[model samples]
Target: MRLADLTTIGVGGEPELIVDAYTREQLVSALNDAWDGDWFVLGGGSNLLASDEPFAGTVIRILTSGFARIDGAPEGFQRVSIEAGQNWDEFVAWTVAQGLQGVEAMSGIPGTAGAAPIQNVGAYGQEIVQTLVSVDLIDEGSSEIVTVPASELGLGPRTSELKRHYGEEPARVAVIAGITLDLRVVGTDPAPVADERIRAALSLASDDAVTLAQIRERVLAIRASKGMVLDPTDADTRSAGSFFNNPIIAEADARLLPESCPRWPVEEVAETVQVFDLATWDGQVPRVEAPASRVKVSAAWLIENSGLPKGFSLPGSRAALSTKHTLAITNRGGASSDEIAELARYVRMRVSGEYGITLNPEPVFVGVEL
Candidate 1:
């Protein structure tokens, strides 16, 4: 089947073998059967940018769906387990309807629940790491399923150990069968917004209180305005969510950027200090302190400053930047995979030449190079 019809970006060639697994057992069998050959799992197909060249391997699509409230949650939280194939936004909607408070700010993200932890999926300031308790996983060659804790996944800003970047291999090769999340049990009650960005976007005061449904409504609306929420009618949402991630750079490098560029400090561990008794100490020198902490700079700001603006496109090319958001490179009707790649390359080159920083593509590339 053509991956173009399957993916959100609507760009890709065909796969040699397509395996649709509708149950956990079938998924396991498919994975085991393809273990010795070239294979990859497909969930919602939202975070991929496949090539026009055909995929020379088996593609396993997970279609299983289900979720249930499990026992044994902390005092004010409730634990729920979700299948890997469940739609992400639908799950978020369910959470809001039930008045859960953790994932409300991440309402309109695409893809499935299983893919969340792979990239530490997040929006505004709400990340899966905040509430993810555990996941049922199986390694590449293992026949048994294991429940892995969230802490071991190496979750970080827009990345996790399992995520395969543009030209890098993941630290682990495994499939998540399901995930468990611990969400606050605040049914129909108002909760204070903890994320500064969400508060600013919603125009809520620091002391203001809002319901879970309210938060989800506002987040979805905001995403729609930026062409982030999926809609067949909106060509701006035709591409993979974000073309590039916000770059995290060293403090010195961040300082070299223009003052108007937006940047945020990344939390860093404080340097360890060693103390000795002055009276009984030997003549040993103390260790020097660590360098300044890193900061994350906005990629959209860099792109616009580098001579690329919203709706910009190369002459005679169908691929263009989204008119609503500069971070997205949209497929205008019949754009080819090569056209998308060309636009992405041009953007990267311009941004690098202007800011001396390389912008990395966020989507997983299959049989495609930047």
Candidate 2:
């Protein structure tokens, strides 16, 4: 089967064989076998780019799905467990319908729940790390199933231990089977919005009261306006949502950009791991301070200011920047995989030449090079 038929962008060649795992047992068995040879897991196909040539590895598509809810937890938080194959937006909608508040700001994200922690997916200042409890997975190294907590995933901006960045190995290897989340209950009552980013995204005034459902609706609307929500008829939506990640750089480098450019402070978190002998060692704790110096710059702002505008296209190619957002590269019907790569490289080159910064692609590349 051709990956084009399964992917959202609809541009790719055939795979040697495509197998779908509909149950946890089948998924686990497939994962165990995949470790013996070349293989990769496929989720919602929303954030992937395959080559025009036949894939030379095993492609396992995870289709297992189940949702379990446990109420009346500590401080009245709702605990829910869901399988990897469940659609993320559908799960978000379910939370809104149930009057849960934590995930309401991330309403229109594509892909599956299992892929969320891999990228630490977030929007409007809300990320999966905020509520993710754990993920059940089969480790590739030992071929054993294990439940990994959120703290061990190394969750960061669009990255985790399971994520494969360009020209770098992933910190960990495993197939996520299911995920658990914790959300607070508000009983369908309107309350003051807590996050500033959400308020700005929705253009709501401070002190404005809204419900969880309202937040979901407004977030979906914002995504739709940016051509982020999937739609068959909208060519702008025929692409991996964001092609490049917002670059996190040193605080000094961030100041070099134009004052008008959008920038956010990314604090450098220092986690100390110390081992001490509790039985004999004297109880004297030493504290040292380290400087926090990091900032995340907006890739879209850099792209536009670097001479590539929204809707810009390469010569004689069907690949172009989305008319609604500069961060996305869309397949304008019948585009070749090579054409897409050419456009991506051009964007990276221009941005680097103009700002002395390198932009990294966010999608997973299979049988393709850029």
Best by TM-score: 1
RMSD to true structure for each model, in Å: 1.5, 3.9
Best by lDDT: 1
> Would you give me the overall lDDT of model 1?
0.91
Error of 1 at 149 (Å): 0.7
* Candidate 2 per-residue C-alpha lDDT over 87-131 given as tens digits, one digit per residue, 9 for 90 to 100: 999998888888887888888888999999999999997999999
- lDDT, model 2, position 333: 93
Instruction: Indicate the worst ten consecutive residues by lDDT in candidate 1.
Output: 266-275
The CA lDDT of each predicted structure is: 0.91, 0.88
**What does candidate 1's lDDT look like per residue over 1-370, in tens digits?**
7999999999998999999999999999999999998889999989998887888889999998988999878999999999999998899999889877788888999999999999998888788999999989989998788999999999999888888987899999999999999998889888678779889878899989999899888888999999999999999999998999999999889999999999988777586787889999987977787777899999999999999999999999999999998999999988999999999999999999998899999998888788
Q: Give the clashing pairs for model 1.
A: none
TM-score of 2: 0.93
